[model samples]
Target: MSRIVFLEERCKGCRLCVEACPAHILRPSGRFNHQGYEIMEMDGQCTGCASCAVMCPDTAIRVFRSVKIRNTAGEGAA
Candidate 1:
């Protein structure tokens, strides 16, 4: 699974990230940030595609991907 982090203070509420996300997981939050603009929030699971991060004009979004390990030894033994 992938996860996304947002720097609320740096966000300008441009909604670029929201439209850029192919998963449709991003949305504008009703609450206002310290800068007085309504920030964006993740509403669903992230695919770690970095679409939102690239579209963010303020560079406030980040995507982290999980690493998976495989059991290589067990497969050959059988």
Candidate 2:
């Protein structure tokens, strides 16, 4: 699983991240932040692709990827 964090105060409500997200999980919050701009919110699963972070002009988005560990001994390998 992936996690996305947004610095709402730094966002300018440009919607660039929203359009850049391939997962289509980003959307406007319909409310303004401290800067009086409509902040972005996540509404779905995040793939940790960093599309939104890369597209964000204000660098308000952050993506964290989960690392999965598999048990090799669980299979018939021995």
User: Which candidate tops lDDT?
Assistant: 2
- How close is every model to the real structure, measured as TM-score? 0.86, 0.87
Tens digits of per-residue lDDT, candidate 1, 1-78, equal 899999999999999999999999999889788989899999988889999999888999988997777768767674
Give the range where candidate 1 is weakest over 10 consecutive residues by summed lDDT. 69-78
Model 1 clashing residue pairs (backbone): none
TM-score of 2: 0.87
Each model's lDDT: 0.90, 0.92
lDDT of 2 by residue, 1-78 (tens): 998999988999999999999989999989899889999999998999999999999999989988878978769865
lDDT of 1 at 56: 88
Candidate 2 Cα misplacement greater than 4 A, ranges? 74-78
Worst 10 residues of 2 by lDDT: 69-78
